[model samples]
Target: MTGHTKAHTMVGKSSQSLPKRILHSGVILYVALAFLALIYIMPFIIQVATSFKTDADATANPVSLIPQVWTTAAYSKLFLNSDFPVWFKNSFIVTIVVTVGRVFFDSLAGYALSRLQFRGRDIIFAMLVAVMSVPMVVLLIPKFLIIKSLGIYDSYAGMILPLLIDASGVFIMKNFFESIPRSVEEQAMIDRAGTFRIFWQIVLPMARPALVTISILSFQGSWNELSHFIVSTQSSSLTTLTKGVASLASGQLSSGNQYPVKLAAAVVMTIPVAVLFFIFQKRIMNSSEGSVKE
Candidate 1:
């Protein structure tokens, strides 16, 4: 009886401590996450703040959250007296086309690899996996050579064509499609519906999460792409924001520690990507919803 009482007492003690332990752990976890968030957001905050400051204020107080003097000279210059608008137009054109093309083409390729049975499908899939492993730097020269040979160099075709599909995107879509119940497609097959019809009407709707995910990635990737643009084009008229912003950051146009002008351009460049991510954050990696019986 005495031993049982002592054992019960120990259990009671542990139970009492559990809440305290949980509270301590929660506090620690929140503190760590908050610290990390601050680190990540600090640079962006500084960029926005400095964008409103003059060159003198930016240089003197590089990390200041509040500018000593706020003015829109940098923004006015970027909008009014520069080729920044043209660069943005090019970026939007390339980004929109690349995002749409990647989603459509990658979906087709991924569906084929996942659902269709063919003799050499396995070999093609393997080759795709291998391509993903190859560093993009190694392919840069080859990409340039191919673009030049195709006679699309120094043009939008060269900029947008090579980026329409990626191995990782294909892999993502294939895996997602395979997870969807095969019975869904079997029903369409019984109805004498074609493969394209089934994919377009039924399968695509269910794969919303994957589609949104890849579209975000493709948009951001193409928007920020530099090396490809560097190799593909030379005309100033065809310059994208990535190339133009790079020049801004490098002080190619603005001279002598003009941090506000540089950072202002960077700030503007990030707005589209930031908005895209927030709008789609809820759909990212969500479980695919479909009706399938056990």
Candidate 2:
């Protein structure tokens, strides 16, 4: 009886300590995560601070998160005295059109590759994989030549069209579509729904996660694209944010470092992409939940 009582007491103590152990572990994990988050976020914080600083202050205290003297001179110059607005407009146009086109065309191609069994289907997929393996830098000359040959050089079409379809986006969608049960489509067929109707109503709607992923990537890629825009456009009126910012960073504007102005441009360029990621973050999280449930 005494031994059993002692054993029960020990068990009770262990049970009582379990919650404390778990709480301690949770605190440690949270601390580690917070530290890592700060590390990643420090650069942006410094950028924002630097943007509000004068050129000399920024250069002097480059790593400082708190500016000694804050000013909006950089922003004022960007908005009023420079071509930033034109660059913003061009980026907006190209990003929107390219994102929409990529979502639609990529989904279409993915569906065809995933569901439709036709002759040379494997060959076509192989070709797509091979194309994806090739470095994008190698295609720069070819792309420029094609744009020049087509007489679309130095135009919005030149900037937007080349980025409309992405091999990776198609691959993502195709893999996603393949993960979906064929019985879902078979049931739609049993109801006598046409292929296009089924794809539009059922498959596409179910592919919300993949579509959102593609949309985010497409928008970010097209917005930050520099090389394509450089080779495609020579006209200042057609300059996108990346090119405009590059020129600013490279001393197109008067003189030394210009850290304040350059950092301001970097911060501004990051906002849209950051907003996009936050907006879709919930959906992205839920996508994982959905995959697990499936």
Candidate 3:
């Protein structure tokens, strides 16, 4: 009886200590995470601070967290004198069209591949995998050739058409479809719904996280796309933000080292993605967590 009582007392002591050990571990983890987060965010902090500095101040205080003398000269030139607005508009248009197209077309293709019973589905999937394996840079010349041959060079069609379908988006949608239980789709089919109807009204609506992923990725890609636009269109009026910014970077239209203008352009280019990110922060976080597991 005495030994049993001592053993029970020891068990009680361990149980009481368990929560304290967990709490201590959690505190250490929190501190480590905070340190890592600061390291990751420090660059953006530096970029924002440096963007406000004058050319001399920026150059002198390369790593300073605060600018010595703040100025807006670069931004003024970018907006008022330069063609930044045209480039901004072009970027906006391309991003919107590409995001919408990829979401719709990619989901459609993914759904068909996942759930449909059709001839050549396996062949189509194999081709898609092969196509996805082809490096994007290698296709630059071929895409330009196709755009030129189609007589859409230097136009919006050339800018938008080749980007309408993306392999990554298709892959994301396909994986998301597979995650969902097949019973939901089967029930819809039992109710005599057409495949397109079932996919549109049923499965797609359940794929909010994947849809957000596709939208964000597509928007970022199309907005920041440089090389494709460089080869697709040659006219200044048709120049997207990426191409225009490259010209600015290489001293095409500006005379001096306009660091402020370039930084402001970078900041402006980042806003849309930033807004979308904040708007869908939860979904983005969940999607990120999900992808990490894969």
List ranges where model 3 is wrong by over 4 Å: 1-24, 285-294
Ordered from best to worst TM-score, the candidate numbers read 1, 2, 3
TM-score of 2: 0.88
Candidate 1 — number of clashing residue pairs? Answer: 0
For candidate 2, lDDT tens digit of each residue in 1-294? 999999999999999999899888798789889999999999899889899998888878899888898699999988998999999999999999999999999999999999998999999999999999999889999999999999999999999889989999999889888877787777789999988898899888888889988999899999899999989999999999999999998899778989999989999999999999998876752345224222
**lDDT ranking from best candidate downward:** 1, 2, 3
Q: Residue by residue across 88-137, what tens digits does model 1's lDDT show?
A: 99999999999999999999999999999989999999999999999998
The window of 10 residues in a row where model 1 has the poorest summed lDDT is 285-294
What TM-score does candidate 1 reach? 0.91
How do the residues 61-137 of candidate 3 rate in per-residue lDDT, one tens digit apiece?
A: 77798887777776777889999999999998888998899989999989988888899989988888999899889
**Clashing pairs counted in every model:** 0, 0, 0
Measured by C-alpha RMSD in angstroms, how accurate is candidate 2?
4.1
Candidate 2 at 294: error in angstroms? 11
Question: What lDDT score is found at residue 37 in candidate 3?
Answer: 100
